[model samples]
Target: MKMTDLILKYLSIKTEVKIPGFGIFQQKNVPAFYDERLAALLPPAKEFFFTEDFNLKDENFIQFVAKEKNIDINESYAEIAELVNYWKFTLQNKIVLEIPDLGTFYFNDEGNFIFKGKHFSTESPENFGLEELNLSELKNRKSALGKSLENEYKTSRNPFWWLLLIIPVTAIIYLGTQNPELIFGKKSFKNLKKTKTDSVVKSRNLLKDSTKIDSTKSKIPTPKLK
Candidate 1:
């Protein structure tokens, strides 16, 4: 069988297929998640990924190939080596190479090999009829969270409404100080208030007399004081 066919067959049954001096092809599970846009749960699925481990030697792979093909072990090793060398050469010269039913490989800017299509999961009997889940509880939770956030935002945007409670108290205190009679009635005070009022009136009268004298002196005299 061709190298690609053998690899595809091995990976169909086995979770990992190691290529000596190259890399390992292994299946991985994509984690499940809640999709807010769809309001559904996405089921986990299998995917393939490559790990380049040069130090790994897969004696079992060669043995399996040799036994399956009924070929000599030395011949199997030589064939595998030739295939690996061809792939490497193709990647280096053409910058990209595709393996049938396995994945695509290409060289990046640093000349490092990059693998794509590993996430293209194969359809297996296990996931043949899988379905996504629609969860009402999750939808309710999201709705509640949205409402809570909106309420918090509104409170923060117009927080000064709470301060309005103090406005009435402040106005009352100001009015009481400026016009105590409004709240306390006209007879609330008598002796001390009258004395203070008399002192203010006397000071105003003295200020008016002094201002009149200064104004008369500052004016120019008429030809004859009429």
Candidate 2:
């Protein structure tokens, strides 16, 4: 039997058509949008919406469809990937893709690629008796919270930065004190040693002069001996 015939046979409520890894198809009733202005322009939107639950692991089903249609599955997959990538890169670029049995997929003015038959409002809010949502305050609050989180992250990383800075500075100070000539270049160490020797000699001379004054005071005669 043809693939479509097989699919149709298994699509009954009791059979619960399962596309391998994809989820089961279950019928659901969707509510219609009640708008007087839209009702005047077009027929009342359909009350039901048919949506598919995609399966990432449905490669076999995809291959079966490709074989049944006499198409190269790999080439088709690549083409689809390219189309999706292009759409993502050029968000403003609009294109229409029509699958054989499925409906057309086209980008609308709002940059959304909605299914052709989906219900959407084209009229202004006044026509629908609706008011614009006041989301400015909520948006501002979220923005403030984001800023607070950014500041907190900066503060948390501050200590690691201080450690990175201090370690290099400490290492330089240690190396400079240990080998002054390495930093100042040639003869700096010799000059430092000579300065220390001169200071020591000057201190010894001052001590000797104080001792001579004490000896002279001891040598003076008493009054009775004179």
Candidate 3:
């Protein structure tokens, strides 16, 4: 079996697979994710993390490989050692090591191993047939709600025009209640009644004068016609 296949085999039944003088591979379960900018929901997934561990020893890995290849323990150990050394040497020389169907492994500036694997998928089998949702309409609704709230806030802060009208009227009511004579003088109703009566009499006199003028004009016969 290939070195990558052995690593996958170890990871299948065990939580962690460590290759002596190389790195450790482990499966980690990740929770569901929400991308606000994309307005998408991503399902839970399984991801692999690789950590360089040079001092790890796995007797079970050796036994499994020896049994699988039908080789003795010594021969299996030697073969495993050769492959691990090759990978380590290549990584030290700053060359990328790619495992087929697994991932590419490289060393960063911090000398830490970074793995980019093809086997890592965000789609979960448990979430089969599920697709990402587009929340564009919900975003529009939220924007409209924000604008409406802003308008309400502005309206609340601004003074009402009717409030200005109420001030003078309120003052009039208060003054009239305190001292009646201030707003309406003595005999206020009588004076108002007299004013209205005077206005009516004046209108009647004007009407009577217009009638007399018309009668006078009619009594004056037109100069005798030739």
Using lDDT as the measure, the top candidate is 1
Cα lDDT of model 1 by residue, 1-226, tens digit: 8888888778778888999987898877775666686677766666678887766688778987898799999998999989888877786686688887777887777888888644443465566656677897768889999999999989876859657867988888988999987877798456664468888999999999999999999999669766
The lDDT, on a scale of 0 to 1, for candidate 2 is 0.51
Task: Show where candidate 1 strays beyond 4 Å.
Answer: 32-43, 109-111, 119-226
Worst 10 residues of 2 by lDDT: 41-50
TM-score-wise, the better of 1 and 2 is 1
Residue 106 error, candidate 2, Å = 10
Model 3 residue 185 distance off true place after TM-score fit, in angstroms: 85
**Candidate with the greatest TM-score versus the true structure:** 3
Instruction: Kindly list the per-residue Cα lDDT of model 2 for residues 152-223, writing each as its tens digit.
Output: 889778988889889999988887999876676767244444468878899999899999989998896768
Ordered by TM-score, highest first, the candidates read 3, 1, 2
Report the candidate with higher TM-score, 1 versus 3. 3
Clashing residue pairs in candidate 1, if any?
none
TM-score of each model, in listed order: 0.47, 0.24, 0.49
Error of 2 at 104 (Å): 9.8
Evaluate model 3: give its TM-score.
0.49
